[model samples]
Target: MNDGLAAVLAALVGLVGAVGGAAIGGMAATRGARVGAETAARATARQVQDQAAVDHMHWLRGQRLQAYQDLLAAYDAYSDAVKAVEQWASREAGDAGRRPGEYVQRVEAFLRAHMVIRLVGPVEARTMSAVLWEALQTHAFKLQDWALLVERRSGDETIAGAREELAPARAAMVDAHDVFLSEATRVVGTPMGN
Candidate 1:
């Protein structure tokens, strides 16, 4: 073979080998980059999931706490109504003849049925709190009926008589307080009695 031809052939063989080696190195680099990307994606997904779980738990806890607070406030109002009833009963039993107000019965029923009355607020009425609240309101209304009965009595109705009518309202209010315990339970994703 001619020297020039042999030299050209050798050069071509070296070029082919160099190109082959470069291609293998490129494939290795691509494989390493793919593994790194997959690992990073998995880590990011895990962090997002953990954060979401934490946020959801916090929201649930808040709802439960608020429910208890609302129920407690309702109970406090009911207790106040009961105290009024005790005072009324005492006054009626005493010899002093202080006449009660005509609307006294209204006040008494409001106190007795306080739970149902207090629940009448738009937001609370819409909630699970509404059931007991409606019952209390109804109880208070019934006390008004009692007052009407007294009004139609053959004997002269004194202010004290009207005031005494309020006694039923006051009792209903106390019952409303009792029922609030159940409403609060509903807020926590549990049954009221539970």
Candidate 2:
């Protein structure tokens, strides 16, 4: 009877040891799985963040390109209109001069483009654009005045004086355009046509 009782006691002790070992192993496995899941979530979050940054950069580049194109088109249109006015001023007094109203559309287009520049352009680019626009406006006003004088058969000296004033304004506009282009290239890389 004593030997039988000792064997039972030993068996019970072994059973408890097995149960404790199983519980410890189960806990270890659960902890490992939790750590793995956390690592995967972190990796996924990092990838998402990286992808968003890339998309934002692409969008910004496109905006800069569009702004540059709009500004160029506006400047070209305004310059052409100014040239037309100059041509009209050079014509004979008896010739029918172009009405100032004819150039209003081009001026409005330029202003709209200038607003776009303000919206999307870097600070330096915006400043340059404003300078160029101011110069263009000065020349446009002078040309308009000259056109009026030409239509009224004003003296040659007065027309010549207005024409002389346009020279510096044109030069300033050209210089501002160059500076704006340089700033754009620096910000957005080389544009089409250099």
Q: Which predicted model would earn the best lDDT?
A: 2
Tell me the RMSD of model 1 versus the true structure.
7.6
Compose the digit string of candidate 1's lDDT tens values, residues 1-112. 9999999999999888889989998899999899999999999999999998877666555645554565555445544553444354344333424323433444444344
Clashing pairs in 2: none
RMSD of each: 7.6, 3.3
Which stretches of candidate 2 lie above 4 Å from their native place?
1-7, 100-102, 190-194
lDDT (Cα, tens digit) per residue for candidate 2, span 97-193: 5554556687778788888878877787788889877877876777677777777778899878877887887888888888887887777874421
lDDT of each: 0.54, 0.79
Best by TM-score: 2
The TM-score values for the models, in the order shown, are 0.50, 0.84
